[model samples]
Target: MTFSLATWNINSVRLREALVLKLLDQECPDVLCLQECKSPVDKMPLEAFAAAGYNHVVARGQKGYNGVAILSKIPMQEAGSHDFASLGHARHIAGKLENGATIHNFYVPAGGDVADRKVNEKFGQKLDYLTEMRDWFRDNRPEKSILVGDLNIAPREDDVWDHKKLLKVVSHTPIEVAHFAETQAAGGWVDVTRQDIPDGRLYSWWSYRAKDWDGADKGRRLDHIWASSDISQSAHSSRVLRSVRGWEKPSDHAPVFASFDL
Candidate 1:
């Protein structure tokens, strides 16, 4: 079967429920993974998603903070959650689909403005998180898996509009980039989006700071869709829905999507 999967950092699922529903209608992805949902599992508006034909959901959430979720039209098994940095953030969730493929949804810490641990605790946590993630993948050695979410690091120079200018930026700093690369290599995960549109400027997020965000287009590829090497050949037709970022009251992130023949 050929099915589509999408990952979006909705910021807050409750606040963006309407937009989520609209995306369901528009994108028609078979499975949708969300990050930064910012609401407890009990508070999630399940009916809205169910009405949109997504009957299965597994999520990790907390009040006004980090969260991740997977919604599927097909039945799913609650695979698990993870605590990477021991920071107690609700940032990871996983599910196994009826098709026998596993999906991991994550929201990596943004690592604040300063890239130094002495002055920035969040930055330190981010590095620790990446280290733990790398070790976990090394141990588990997942196959037929799709790893996705707002990884919060732009690992490639082409991923950021102004890589040199953003060298001091939290997401594009050399340390974070190295750590992120290590995590990716540890899992042997093929960055699905990059595989489809390699060697070019690509972005899934744009800061709201710009007056004409679309015009200025100083964006970063913080969000990602990576798949295990075993299933990499089945992955295809990936794209970032930049139009969603233009929607009224939209989240800073746009959805990244891919199709796979399983």
Candidate 2:
């Protein structure tokens, strides 16, 4: 079976329901995983997504904060969810497709502006969350799984527009990058996006503060798509829909995509 999947951080699903529908209508990916939905599951406007032919959904949400949802054209059953670091946030959800491939959608905490955990509680929470993820994956050892979402960290130098300048920044900090690398290693997850586009300054998110985001081209590869080593070889054709960030009232994030022939 061949299928395509996309991951996006919609920021607020309720406010951008139209944009979500537009993506479904246009791109029509087999599976679409969203983070930062910022709405309760009951209020997610799932009916609209259903009408768009994505009748299957697995989600965990909160009132106006972190949330995740997977809308799939193919049938899938809810696998589970986790509250990493006991932060009490709706940040992770998983679903199992009929083809036996499990999909995990996550919205990792974006460590606050300050990178120091000693002074910044949010930064501490982010690191703790990543640590817990590493431990969980180490114990669970997932296989035939695809994990995707707004991980909120740019692990590589090329992932950020100015890596040297952002080294002290929250997302590109050494400590956070170490935690991210440990988690990837623990899970044995293959970065399907990087594997396809091996060389380039790829980015999935741009700061809203940028007056001319496109012209300035200051962005970060905050979102990611990863597959288990067992199925990584089947993943290909990865790309980021950069133009979506320019859509009317769009999210700061653009959708990242990968196709799989399983």
Candidate 3:
């Protein structure tokens, strides 16, 4: 079966519920993985989602904080949920599709303003989170899996608007990128997005602080979709829905999409 999938950091699922519905109506991906939902599962508008054809869901949620959920039109069951770094945040959840492919949706912490862990606890948590991710993948050795989310790190040089200027910035910092690469290497995951669109300044997140976000284009490719090497080749049609970022009361993030044949 071939199905299209999208990963988006909805910011606050309850706050942007309408936007989510709009996306479902417009894009209609078979599977949608959401991060930073910031709404407890019970409080989320699941009834509305089911009304739109995404009747299956696997999720881990917390009230007004980090949360992740996977909504699918296709049949799927809860695979597992992990608390990397023992942060106890609703940051990681997994679902197994009927085709036996596992899908992981993650929301890695965005290290705070200062990159130095010595000065920032959030930065330390970010590093520790990545470390745990690496260890988990190393042990699990995932196959026939696809991982996607707002990973919160831009590993490639072209992933940010100004590579050199953003080198000291949290998301593009060298240490963060190194940790991100280690985590990706651990799973032997293929970056489906980069594989399909190998060049150009690609970005799925733009700062709300930007007065002219589109014109300035000071964005970062913090969101990603990855497939395990075993099934990576079957992934295609990867793209970032940039226009969605301009939607009214939109989240800072735009959805990143890819289709897979399994």
Candidate 4:
């Protein structure tokens, strides 16, 4: 079976329901994973998504905060969810497709502006969350799985527009990147996006503060798609829909995509 998947941080699903529908209508990915939905599951506009031909969904959500959801045209069953670090946030959810490939969607905490955990509680939470993810993956050792989400940290130097300048910044900090690396190692995950486009500065998110976002081109690769070693070889044609960032009242993030021939 061949299928395509896309991961996006919709920011607020309710507010951007139209944009989501637009994506479904245009791109028509076989599956679409969304993060930061910021609405209760019952409140999510699932009917609209259903009408768009996404009949299967698995999600965990909270009011006005972190949330994750997977909408798929193909059939899928809810696998599970986790509250890493006991942060009490709706940040993770999983689903198993008929083809036996499991999909994990996550929205990792974006460490606060300050990178120091000693003085920043949010930063500490972010690190703790990543640590827990690493430990969990080490114990479980996932296979035939694909993980996608807004992981928040940019592990590679080329992932950020100005790596040297952002070294001390929260997302590109050494500590955070180390933690992210450990998690990937634990799961034996291959970065599908990087594997396809191996060389260059690639970004999935741009700051809203930029006056001329496209012209300045200051961005970060905060979102990711990872597959286990067992199925990584089947994943290809990875790309980021950068033009989506220019959509009307769009989320700061652009969708990351990949196809799998399993």
Clashes of each: 0, 0, 0, 0
lDDT of 4 by residue, 123-150 (tens): 9999999999999999999999999999
| Candidate 3 lDDT, 115-147, residue by residue in tens | 999999999999999999999999999999999
Where does candidate 2 have its weakest 10-residue lDDT segment?
A: 198-207
Task: Using lDDT, give the best candidate's number.
Answer: 4
Q: lDDT per residue, candidate 1, 1-262, as tens digits?
A: 8889999999999999999999999989999999999999999888899989999999998999898999999899999899998999999999999889999999999999998999999999999999999999999998999999999999999999998899999999999999999999999999999899887899999998887899999999999999999999899999999999999999999999999999
**lDDT of each model, Cα atoms only?**
0.95, 0.97, 0.96, 0.98
Ranking by lDDT: 4, 2, 3, 1
Deviating ranges (above 4 Å) for candidate 4 = none
Off by over 4 Å in 2: none
Report the C-alpha lDDT of model 2 over 67-111, residue by residue, as the tens digit. Answer: 999999999999999999998999999999999999999999998
- Positional deviation of 237 in candidate 3, in angstroms? 0.3
